[model samples]
Target: MNDGGFSALVVLDDLAAPRFSPGAAELLALMDSVADACPLDSAALHAQASAELGLGDFGPRDYEERLEVLLAAYRDAPRLSRAGRVNLHAQFLQLLKNRLLFTDLLRREPGIAGIELAPPVVIAGLPRTGTTHLLQLLAATGRFRTLPYWEGLEPFPLPGEAGVVPEPRRERTQAAVALMNDAMPHFARMHEMADADHVHEEIALLASDFSTMYFETLTEVPAWQEYYAGHDQAPHYRYLRLHLQALQHLRPGPAGAGRWLLKSPQHLEQLPVLAETFPGATVVITHRDPVHVVTSMATMVAYTDRMFSDPTDPAGTGRRWAARIERMLDALQRDRSALPPDRAVDLPFADLMADQLGAVERILAMAGERFDAAARSGAEAYLAGHAAGHLGRVDYRPELVGLDPDDLRRRFASYERRFLPSEEPLPVDN
Candidate 1:
């Protein structure tokens, strides 16, 4: 996805795979020009990572295991571009730096451990379902402090770094975004981002734990994916809380009191753990027809993977991601009763987009929060000034990704009956 300081991808046409711009192509060729070692040496990489961060106790020993799997992926994956390799390396270094710096902060300032968080406001949904749009609206209210793109990229400051000074990574992030956009112009249509973009994904912070959906977005590594699935993600969520506390301690919230406003598609399946990590969290789950969810998400993944692959599997992407979404739905359904009724709410994408502020008001009301005049006015202004970015009216056929409408409908039948009864029914033939 977005490498270094940014993350994500989409845009489609007549081919099984999208074409790279000439500049992007030339850049990839140059990256391939000077070949180096394959399957980067894990020990050497760790040593380099250690040196990169001024050498600290990188906390738990678990991340190194993930590093091995990732290195194996780079070495084995065929047709990976040189630029793709460079991006992956940059991402790994960032994660290691995050782990070192974050742990160092906690060790030196145990008071950071005491930084209290109100039950956070979490926006959960399938991708492209107005989740990001909602977070932006809420963030504009100036009532919550969100995880900005820069914080997620680095997550913590250096050993003795603090103050309201200019961001240390500001120039580097802008340069990276420029280079990425300059090479692949289509990126803007996929998911727009900048160095200071607010309401960033939680997956970026998960990378510090070396357990994240970020890797899944970048490549097709079944072993790694399987390993991730089998493990207990509660530990990762535990680390997630620590990182959030660290962020709050580093940059005191608005007026010395504001909750964390976090969003991610990955949260759909981890609701239980999320609830455990932050008790009484106000969780908002957004729904869209699974048919749209699968195909669109596949396109997003297609764009990012294409940077690292050629002849990517659109249909396979469809099938795998479709299954994953359905599984998440199933998990949510199973755990629905476990969540506190007053603390949870559901919003349909169509409704949220139609009246974004109203939908948020409904959500806040359910969480026992007030939608004050200031919030209403701020959201109205945000909507008046900004519009959803244009994604041209190009067709995205489900069959192209090997998905059958009826089959997907059956797969998501329970989800529909539970949360989308009044919504548009899936187009399926008996």
Candidate 2:
């Protein structure tokens, strides 16, 4: 709420001025059409739209003015690429519809003690430290319920039994997968995705509030990123918990199943806050050489940028990523000291890969849980099925991405010394 501390907060008054580029206008128009069809609550709709547009506290008067400008732009714009525009519009509409419905349900049923969410496990680490793979692997164990991409995106009105059939969801997911493959085939090689596979960082849910690091990665908008960088990410975590509660209530899982397994690289930067929110939660910290992490992360960012824009700048990606990782390391260090020793577990990427089963067994042990043979075998089968080739398919050079390998290594020297195995180099590229 206090703008002084956050580098990313924008006074709502300033954001009231309409500043839509041609491309942004086109996108906004799509969103408008979708929202119109869905017909969400006006106040909630405005809040959602404001967040999407990255408009901070312009107060009530400014909110109306800004919304008018945005609506006018959509009304005046000519139809764009039908396929792309329609898809974007539909996605936003669906998102708004779900959020509004969920919010209404929560309000109406204030007494609803949603299905209890417990035994929480949070997978957190620097980007490209194998956090994604680890999450998918853990999800496959069947001991935990992970928020699938589809469910996470649409967490309202309770998905019906007809929707439970995996076919429709799988088909939709496959289509999106095909599009991504067509657009950026290189990414699939690095990260294998299936319709049922677990995804990381439900940022879209957080994006509903415009307070997320995801905005930075989506656009080359430094001003917006700077505003978010300084703000507290704790609210997003709170939103996550509420949604998880809603999801559990809507879709009860197997009897006595533990709480949701949530994974996100962003969680690393808000470790202390996350611990405070979920005190009993099990936290798994993944570690890897900083240099390799940067390189791998830059490549992934480069690939993602290509999907939405032209001319992905690898160096710019690396620099932004480096800054974020730096913040995360700082947070982790501070939180590690504050948290009880038993609540946290540190793991090496290399060790996890070398013996996936053993690594997971130890992790579960640390969390005070035991894995049944079926869960263990399921995890093993998942690893064998996914394979290592899927793990870092995109070979990237730190130097090519404008990263000085030595400098990066030096920057994370303290982290390496404290967490990395003695035999491993502080910033080993490979």
What would the TM-scores of all predictions be? 0.89, 0.75
lDDT by residue (128-222, candidate 2, tens digit) is 77787888887777777677766665555333433555645545656666555554434554455545444645666665444556645542555
Give me the candidate number with maximum lDDT: 1
Candidate 1, residues 1-430: lDDT per residue as tens digits? 2232222222255236566668777877776665363226667666777887677688888778877887787667665666567667767777777777877777889897777878888898877676777888887776777887777787776655554367666545666777777765555555556446545877888888878666878867666777777877898988888888888877777762378888988888888888889898888888887777777677667656766666677777787788778777887888776668888888877767767778878877765667888778878898786565432222356776778889988888888888888775342110
After the best TM-score superposition of candidate 2, give how far the Cα of residue 276 lies from its true spot, in angstroms.
Answer: 1.5
Best-performing candidate as measured by TM-score: 1
- Model 2, runs deviating above 4 Å: 1-94, 112-115, 157-171, 196-199, 390-392, 425-430
Clashing pairs in 1: 2-6, 2-7, 2-8
Computed on alpha carbons, the lDDT of every model, listed in order, comes to 0.72, 0.61
Cα miss at 377, model 2 (Å)?
1.6
Give me candidate 2's TM-score against the actual structure: 0.75
